[model samples]
Each structure stands twice: as structure tokens, then as C-alpha cells.
Target: MMVKPLATNRSSSGMSTGKLAVWWLIASEIVIFGGVLASYLMFRLGHPEWGAAASHTNTWAGALNTMVLLTSSLSAVLAHQAAEQGDGKKAARFLYFTVLGALMFLVIKSFEWTHEIGLGFTLQSGGFWSFYYLAAGIHAAHVIAGAIIMIWVAAYAKRNEELQRVEYIGIYWHFVDIVWIFLFPLLYIAK
Candidate 1:
């Protein structure tokens, strides 16, 4: 009887385990965000007062953050491309730039929050304010988490000659950007 070699390294299919895992994580994230978005829509329709309160949110700030996230996404893609080409150093550089963009987004958000809260528009101000802060805050947390992940990927790239993790990290980062795209128009652009 001949013994077969145990299946190892990537699945029998050849699909990277890292990429597959990221997709699963993204699918779960979609459900969580979908639920949040659905609840927001229902709340928006149920209460007319929210519209008036929503008017108080700074659209320009939100727009700036949108730009920041978009730029970071571009950097993340470039980073992943570099990694796939086995240029870990270049990938690390791009990842660091992406992190900078994320930090810029957070700083802008902090300023927006401070300005709004100082204007006596606290989360307790009204239904819209509550939802606005809640949604935006949750998204901001995701941004921070993505940035931290990027930092870890960057560190790995610096010390290693080749890293398959960069591409998966890029995928997750892009998903974060896509979520913000939907959120930007809904929370900031849409009156």
C-alpha cells in the first residue's frame, strides 16, 4: 500500500488560505454593516426630526475623510501589487503611506466631532445626532483597526523577503474603503 502525502500548503484547490479567510471575514462584516444600515434607514424614515438634525453634520469634513480613505485604498492596492511581485520593501513603503492616509482621516474626524459637540450638538441632542455619531464612530473604529493591520503587515514585509499576507490585507483594507463610500453619501451627502 502506498501512503499519500498529506495535503499541505494552500488547499487542494490552490486558492490561498489567507485570501479565503479574508473573504469570509469580509462577508461577515457585510452582514454587520448591512444590519446597521438597514436600521438607520428605518430610523430615518420613522422620524422626520432626524433630517433636521442631520443638517447640522459637517458635509465638508465628511468629504475630506472620504478623500483620505480613497487615497489610502489606492496605496493599499499598490502595496499589494508590489508584494505579489516579491518587492517587499516597496510594498512596505506603500503600506506606510496607506497608514498615513488612515491617520489623516481619523484626525479630520476628530476635529469634526469636536466642532459639532462643541456646538452643543451632542449625541443626546436628537435621534439623528445619535445615529450620526453611532454610525460614524463605528466606521472610524474600523478605519483604525484596518490601519493597525496595515502597520503589522508593513512590519512583516520589512523583515521578510516575501509575504503573501500583504494582498489579503489589501483586500480587507479595500473593503473598509467601500463601506465608507456607501456611508459617505448616506451620512454626509444625502440630505
Candidate 2:
């Protein structure tokens, strides 16, 4: 017989245990990402010369990635809704779509980095380049992590098991997309 974990515990806050956990994690992540972006903004504001470096960044590529991530977030929402409706197969399909969007964002980002690096905009190039790579790289790492977890979650969702986890992963995926939304303008459009 399959054993069910304590997956049904609703907190006093009217949230599931799993959802509360995801929110707690997201709160912690906000601190981390907030620190990085705040620091970048401070530096960018103080150093006007950084605009030149920022201008070198490919805005079109950043915008494209932004669109991709937003679309992925929509798929994640659909996955959560499917899970809620007891449609595990549909949830898994939407989760796969979300993962595809994550991969596409990464691919576009990689090409953008390749082009920048080809033009000698290395991380060691200057302060602006350093912050650019650092912030974007951290966000990219999160994308990779979200994609991997999503694949695992999708597997169980396909089997109609742990349907609640679909919602949990969707929360995490949305957080990742939100981070990109902040990063895109700070690192790309601020020029």
C-alpha cells in the first residue's frame, strides 16, 4: 500500500503545509536576491559611466527571455490548476511546457553571454560587467535548479501521485520568473 505523508495539514493561516513551506522559502530568497539587486542599483546610480557597459548588453535578447519566462509562469499556473482539479496528466503536460520555457530562456541567455564574451565583455572587464554577470549568473543557476525539480515533480504528477507538489513547484517557478523580471530591467534596460 502507498503511504501518504502528512500532506494534508492546513495551518492556522489557512494555507497548506506544503504551500506555507514554499512561501517561507520564497521569503528567504527575497532577502538574498534583494541584497544583490539593491547593491547593483546603488552602484549603478553612483557610477554614471556604467551606462556605457549596460548599453552593450543585448536588450532584445533580455526582452525575449523575459517573455519566455512569463509564458512559463502561465504554464505553471495551468499546472497548478490542473492539479487542483485532479487532472494529473494535464498538470504534468503543463509542467513540461514550463520546463521547456525555462530551457529556452537559458538557451537565449547563453547565446547572449557568448556574444558578449566574444566582444570581450568578460566578467573581469569592469565593475559593471562584474555585476552584470554575477546577477545574471545567479538567476540562471536558479533557472537550472527550477527546471530540474520541475522534471522530477512532473514524473510524480504523471503517475497521479503527490498532486499537491505540483502547486508547490509552481510557486517556486513563479518566484524564479519574478526574479528575472527584476533582473531584466536592471541589467538590460537601465541603459
Candidate 3:
């Protein structure tokens, strides 16, 4: 007979394994974003001229994207709640709304980037543009990743009845939003 090992929920330190794992992941992410933002601040401080360069970015677009992300966070929370209630269908619906928000965010971002580049604001324009592209581009990538995760979570909820993970994914999705909350002010409104 083949023996199946039991998967325990408690870690060696007596912490809930899932929560500990999520916290570890979040801690690593903080290191990554923190390093990037610190470097950006250092550069911005050293080069006082970057202020005028920062002003060229569209504030309205940044504000709109912030709203989109905030709304997505709300949808993610709703999805998690539905999952907790064992309503897979409702969970899927809320997840779909979250995905739609990501799509909207990307569309707006695309237009904003194209318009800015058309106005001669390429990455080569200056150090500020470089950082702008780097920061926004990374945030957009995270948005894409979150959307993909949402789709998978929704599908799993539909067939596997595994809605408990909704909360985990929601936490990650909210982290992405929180990053944007800081990025918006640093890149768009700081100047």
C-alpha cells in the first residue's frame, strides 16, 4: 500500500502555514518595491530639473487609473466574501468584475503612454522619463499578473469548489493597488 503523507496546516513555529507563506511573499515584495522606489527618490532628489519633467505626465490619467485600481480592489474584496459564503457563482462574477477593471486600467495606460510618447516624452527623454516608464511598466505587469490569477481563481471556484483561496488572491490584488497608490503620488503628483 502506498502511504499518503498528511499535509499539516501548522508550521514549525506554530503559525498557520498559509498565512505565514503569504506574509513571506508580501515581505519579499516589499523589499523589491522599496528598493525601486528608494532609487527613484534618490535620482529625483539629485536632479532638481526632474520636477519640470514630471509635470509632463498626465495627472488625469493617473487619477483615473487610481480609481480603476481602487474599484478592482473592491471587487476582489467582494469575491473573497462570496467565496467565504460558499457561493462559487457569485465569487466568479465578482472575479470577472475585477478582471474587467484590470482591462480598463491597461487600456487607459496604453493610451496615456502613447500620447506621452507622441509628445516627445520617450524613455530617452531624460532620467525622469526612464523612471516613469520603469515604474508604470512594472505596475502594469503586476496588473496583468493579477488578472490572470483572478481568471484561474474563478475557474477553480467554478469546478473545484475551492473558493477559500479567494481571500489569498484578494490580498495580493490589494497589494498591487496599494503599490499604485504610492506610485501615483511619486510619479504623477509629487511635483
Best model number under TM-score: 2
Candidate 3 positional error at 122, Å: 1.6
RMSD of 3: 2.3
The prediction achieving the highest lDDT against the true structure is 2
Whose TM-score is higher: candidate 1's or candidate 2's?
2
| lDDT string, candidate 2, 66-163, tens digits | 99999999999999999999999999999999999999999999999999999999999999999999999999999999999999999999999999
Candidate numbers, best lDDT first, in rank order:
2, 3, 1
lDDT of 3 by residue, 1-191 (tens): 95434343445766555656767887888898888889999999899999999989889999999999999999999998888888888999999999999999999999999999999999899999999998888889989988998899899887646676787788889999999999999999978
Model 2: CA > 4 A from native: 1-10
Which regions in candidate 1 have their CA more than 4 angstroms from the true location?
1-8
Q: What lDDT does candidate 3 reach at residue 78?
A: 91
Models 1 onward score TM values of: 0.92, 0.95, 0.91
TM-score of 1: 0.92
